[model samples]
Target: MEENKREVQVTLVESILIMIGMFAILGALIIGAEMPPQIPILLVFTLLMFYGRLRHVTWDQIFAGIIEGIKPGIIPIMIFLMIGLLVSSWLRSGTIATIMVIGFKILSAQFFLLTVFLICCLIGITVGSSFTTISTMGIAFMGIGHILGFSAAITAGAIVSGAFFGNNMSPLSDTSNLTTGLTKVNLYDHLKNMAITAIPSALITLGLFFILGRTSSTADLTQTQQISQQLQRSFNVSIWALLPILVLLLLAWRQVPAIPTLLVGSLTALVVILVSSPGYSVSQIGTLLMNGNAAKTGSHTVDRLMSGGGINNMLGSVSLIIVALALGGLLIQYGVVHTLITSIKQYVNTPGKLILLNMLSGIGVNFLVGEQYLSIILPGTTFMSSYDRLGLPRKYLTRTLASGGADVNALVPWGVSGVFIAGTLGVNPLAYVPLAFYAYIDPIITILFGFTLVTWRYRRSGKRPATSTATTSVGLKDRDQPVN
Candidate 1:
C-alpha cells in the first residue's frame, strides 16, 4: 500500500483544474448565490472526496486525511469556545462596558480610527492572540465606533489590520514562533527582519486610517453621553472590571499557553462579577455563561452592544472551521497541494523568484486550505532547502512567512481567522478585506525587497547558514514538528 501510494502522484494539470473548480464553486455559491460559507465549503469537500476516489485514493485514506487536518484546528476550536465564555463573562462583569465608557470619555472623533488601531495594536502585542484582541478590545471598539457613527466595515478593517500587525510581531504569537522555528531562524532576528516590511506597511496603514478618521461623520456627543450614562447604570463600571483583561495579558506575557490563559481569564471574570456586583448568585452566573448576558439595560444601544456572547454564538464558527479543515485535508491527501508546490519549484532559480513564489504559495495555501498554520508550515518547509542553497539567511524565509502566511489569513473569507473575526465583530468577512492594509501591504514590500535585495543577507561562501540555538528556547523539539 505504501509503495502504491508513493507511485500515485497528482499531475500539475489535475491540481490546477481542481483549484479552478474549487474557486468556481466557492465563488458561485458564496458570492453569486449569496449562501453562507459553510454550505459552499461542504459542497467543495464532497466534490473533492469524489475527485479523490477517481484518483484511486481509498475512503479510509480520505477519512484519515480529514482527521489529520482537523488536528491542527482542535486547539483553535477550544480557544473559540473559551473566547465565547470569556466575552460573555466580561460582559456580565462590566469589563467591556467599562472600556466603552472610558473610551467615550477620552477618545475623540477626529482620531477615533487611529486611536483604535494603536490601542488594538498594544492589546494584540500584549496578548499575542488576534482572536483575543478581536473579541475583547475589538468588541469594545466596535461599540464605540457604532456610537461614534463610523461604519462597521471600516472599523473592523482597522481592528484587523492592527491586531494582525501585533500578532505577527509579538514574541509569544504562535504563528510568528512557528515560522521562525520551522525555518530554523533566531526568533528575534526574524522579528527584526520582518520590520523591514512591517514598518512601512504599518505606517502606510496608519496614514490611511488617519485620513479616514478625519473624513468620518462628526461624533454625536449627546448620543455618546447618553450611552455612557446608560452603561454605567446597567453595569458596575469600575477599575475592578479591568482585572480580567489584565489577567489575560499577564498570562500571555508569562508565556502561558493560550487555552489556560483564556480559562483563567474567564474564571477571573466570574470572580469579578461575584465580588463586584454581589447581586447575582452562583447559579445565575452559570446561566449567564451558558446563555449569555440577559440583562436588559433599558437603553437600546447598550442592549445591542451587550446582548451577544456564549457558546451558542460560537457554534457557527466552529462548524465552519471543521468543514473548511476537512476540505483542506482532502486537498492535501489527494496530492493537489503537493503537485502545485512541486510544479512551481522548477522556476524558482533566483532569490527574487523564490521569495515571490514563497509569498504567493503561502497566500495560495490560505485560500485553498483555509488554515493559517499550513500556510506557514507548507511553504516554509518546501522552500527551506532552496533558501539555504541560494545562500540566503533563513530569516528572510521566516519573515516572508509572517508577511504572507500569518498576516494574509485574516483576509481569506473562509479562513479560520476570518471566520472567527467575522463572527465576533458581526461584520461580513469580505467587507473588511479591502481595508486590511497591513495584511496585504507587508507581502508587497517583502516581494520588492526580494527583487531589490534591499534587506537580504547572504551566507559566507562555501558555508551554509547556521541554525539558531535560540530556537530551543521557543520549545521547538525538532524542525519536523512545530509546537501547537
Candidate 2:
C-alpha cells in the first residue's frame, strides 16, 4: 500500500540548501551559459520538485502548491495581456505614432542628452513601458547622439535612466502594477510613496545629463526629420490620436481597476482605428489584436518602433510568472521561505534594517537570477512578514522592490533588461552602467529614507505586537518576534 504523508516543515539547513542550489543553477545557466531566464527558471522549478519529492511531498500536494503560488499572479498576468492589446491597438490607431512625432519635433541638439532623457521619460510614461520606449525613442536618440558626436555610452545611459524613471512611476507600468499587486498595496498609493525617492533621483539624473550633454557642434537634423517623416507618413499624427490615452488617464485617475481600465483603453483605440481607417477589415483588426501591428513604414527604425504588442507577445511573461510563482509556492509550501525568514528575523530588527535587507536581497537576486521579475517576487515574498510585524505598511515594500529590483535590472550585464537595452542601443551594457544614474540613485535614496525614517508610515496604533501569527495558503504560519 502507498503511504500518505503530511506536509513537513523544512529546516533551516534544508532551506539554505535549496537557496544555494537555486542560486547555483540559475547563475550557471542564466549567467554562465547566457540562456534566457525562462529555461533557468524552469530548471530551478524542477530542482525544487525533486527536493520536494525526497521530502515525501505527493504530486497532488505539489500541484496544489503550484496553484496556490499562481493565484496571486493571475491578476497580473491578465493585466500584462491587456497591456499587450492596448499597445497594439494604440499603435494601429496612430496613438503611439502621434506621440513619437510630437517628441521628435521638440528635440534640440544644444541640450541633446537632456532632451533625450526628457523625451524618453515622456514616451515611457505615456506608454507605461520601458522596453517600448527604449526600443523606439531610445534607438532614435542613439542615432542622433552618434551624429552629434556624443559618447554612445552616455547617451545609452540617459535613455535607460529616463525610460526606467517613467516606468517606475507610471500607473500603467506592468512592473509597478506587479509590485503593488504582490504587496497588496493600492496602486496610486504605491506610486505616491515611490515619488518620495523617484522625484529626487530624476532631478539628479537630469542635472547630470545636462552637464554631460554640453556639445558645441551644430548637428544636421536629417536623421530626425527622416524618422519623423516616416512616422507621419505611416500613421495619422493628429490631436485626435490622443483621445484613447486621455481616456486611460482619466480612468486611472478615478482609481478604476487596472484590467478594466486597460480594456476600455484598447476598445477606445479600436473605435478610433475603425473610424479613421474605414478600409481596415475586421479580420485585419483581429490580426492586429492577436499578432500585433505588421505594416512597415519603409524605414527600418520606424518599422522597429511600430512593430510590437498583441496578446501573443505577453505569453512569455505570462509563462514566466506562472512558473516562478509555482516555485515560490513550493518554497512556501515546503516551509523553505518560513525557515529562512525565521532564521533572518532576529537580524532585521528595525524598519531600516528590514528595508536594507530587502533591497540587498532584491539586488542579489537580480545579479544571481538575471531576471527582474524574480528579483521582485522572491524578496517581496520573503520580507512581507517583516514589513507587517514592524507596523510598516506594505507600500514601502512595493517602493523598495521597484528601487532594488525592477530599476536595477537594466544595469546588470547579464540581466534581461540589460541585454535588451545593450542590443537595441548598440552599446555595451557595462559601459552605460556609470551613466544610468537613476537606477542606483533610487535605491540609495530609499535606503537613506529607511535609516532616517523619512516618509515612513506606520500603523494607526504606531505600536506593533511582539508577535503575530498568520496562516495562509502559502503557509506563512511562523510568528515574527521583532527585536526591541
Candidate 3:
C-alpha cells in the first residue's frame, strides 16, 4: 500500500515536470522555433524524466496511458472533422461569400468596426463557433480594417469579443452543450438564463466599439472597393447559395447529430456548386473540397481570407488536438490530473463560491497546462457538488465554467488554441489579448451574476429539501425541488 502511494506521488511529480517542459517548448514554438524539432526534444525529455522517477512503469505502459487519456476526446475529434466538412461545403455553396458581400455593402468606414462586432455576434449566435467566425469572416474584416485605416489590434479585438460573446450564448456550441450536459440542465433554459448577463456584456462591448469606430477616422474607399470586388469576382455569390448554411443551422437547432448535420450541409453545397458554378468541373470541386479554397486574387489579404475548409485544412489542428489530448490523457492515467482536481475540489463550498472557483480553476488550468478542453472538464466535474449543496441551478454552473473555459483560449500564448489561432492569423496572441475585451469580461460577468442572485434559480422557501446530496455526481441527476 505504501509503495502504491509512493508510486502515485512520483508519477504526479514527473507529470508536473513534463507539463513544465511542454510549456517551455510551447514558448519556443510561439517565438518561431520549428515545431518538428521542438516536439521530439520535449518528448524525449518528458520520457526520460518520467522514466527516472517511475522506472517500474514501462514505455509501452506510458504510451498506453497516453492513448487512454486521449480516448475521451474521440467524440470531439469527430466533431472537428465534421466542422471541417461543414466549412468546406458551406464555402463552396456561396453562404460565406454572400455574407461577405452583404456585410461589405452595409459597413461604411464610420460603422465598419461596430459592424464587424455586431456581425460576429450574430454569426456566433447562429453557428456557435468563435474560432470559425474569426478564421472566416474575421480574416476578411482584418483586410477591411486595414483598408479603413482602423488599427488591426482594435479590429482583432472586436472580432474576438463579438465571436466569443455569441459562442457563450449559443445553444449549438460544444462548450455550451458540454456544460449543460455535465450539469443536467435544459439547454434552452440555460441560454435564456444567461441572457441576463450576456446581453449586458455584449451591449457594453458594442457601445465601446461604436464609440471607437466613430472617433477613429481612417477610410480608404479604393482599398475597400477592391476587397469587395475581389470577393464578388472569386465565387458565384447569391442568396440561393446560402441555403446550406441555413440548413446546417436549422439541423443544429434541432439537436441532430453533428456528423450528419455537417454531411447534409456539405451535400447541399456541392449541389449548389454544380448547378451555379458551371465553370468548375466535378474533379476540380473534389480538389477544392479536399484542399480548401485558395485566393487567386493576387492579393495576400484576399487569399488568406478566402481559404476555408478542405479536408487538408483540418490536419494541423487535428494533429495538435491529438497530441495535447494525449498528454492530458497520460496525466489522467498516471493520476496527476486526479490529484490536481482532488486538491482543487476541497476549496469550493457555496454555490457562488463554486461558480467562482470553477471559473478560476478553468482559467488556471489553461494557464498552467496550456490546454482548453481539460480546463473545462476538470473544473466542471470537480465542482458539480458544490452547486447542488447551495441549491443553485446546474445551468448556472455550466454557464460559469464555459464562459470562463473555452472562450479565452486564444489569450494564453502557450495554450494550444492560442498558438493555433496566432499561427493562422499571423498575429501574436499576446498582441491581441489586451484587445480581447469579451474574453476578459465573460468570466467576470458570469461570476457577478452568480453572486448577485440575478437570473439564478434555486430552492424555494416552502419547498427546500431537508437533505440533499452533496457530491459532484449529484448534478448529473435531476433535482426535483423548485428553485428560488
Instruction: Kindly provide the TM-score of model 3 when superposed on the true structure, using C-alpha atoms.
Output: 0.80
Lowest-sum lDDT 10-residue window in model 2: 475-484
- Could you give candidate 3's per-residue lDDT for residues 299-354 as a string of tens digits? 78677666677778766666665665666555655566566556666666555566
Candidate 3 yields a Cα-based lDDT of 0.68
Error of 1 at 265 (Å): 0.7
Task: Give the least accurate 10-residue stretch of model 1, judged by summed lDDT.
Answer: 475-484
Q: Compared with the true structure, what per-residue lDDT tens digits does model 1 show for residues 1-484?
A: 4444455467889899989999999999998999999999999999888878887888778887898788899999999999989999999899999999999999999899999999888888888889989999999999999999998999999999899989987898899889977876778877787877888888999999999999975678899999999999889799999999899989999999989998899999999988987777878877787777776977777899987888888999999999999999888877788889868887976668889999999999999999999999999889887665555667778988888888889999899999999999999987889988888988999999888753233311233322444332323223322111
Computed on alpha carbons, the lDDT of every model, listed in order, comes to 0.86, 0.76, 0.68
Question: What is the C-alpha lDDT profile of model 2 across 1-484, one tens digit per residue?
Answer: 1123235578888778888888788778866887766788888889888878887888877877777667766766676678778878887888878866776677666688898888778867777878767755675566557556577898899999999999998888889988988877788888888998999999999998887776533466787688778888888778998898788767755657667878998999999998999998999988999988775877776777677778887676666656666776677677675566456657886778888888988886666545678778888988887777665667788999999999998887656677567654657765898999999999999999888753244332355534665322223222222121
Ranking by TM-score: 1, 3, 2
Give the TM-scores of the predictions, in the order they appear: 0.93, 0.72, 0.80
Task: Please report how far candidate 3 places residue 322 from its true position, in Å.
Answer: 1.8
Error of 1 at 107 (Å): 0.6
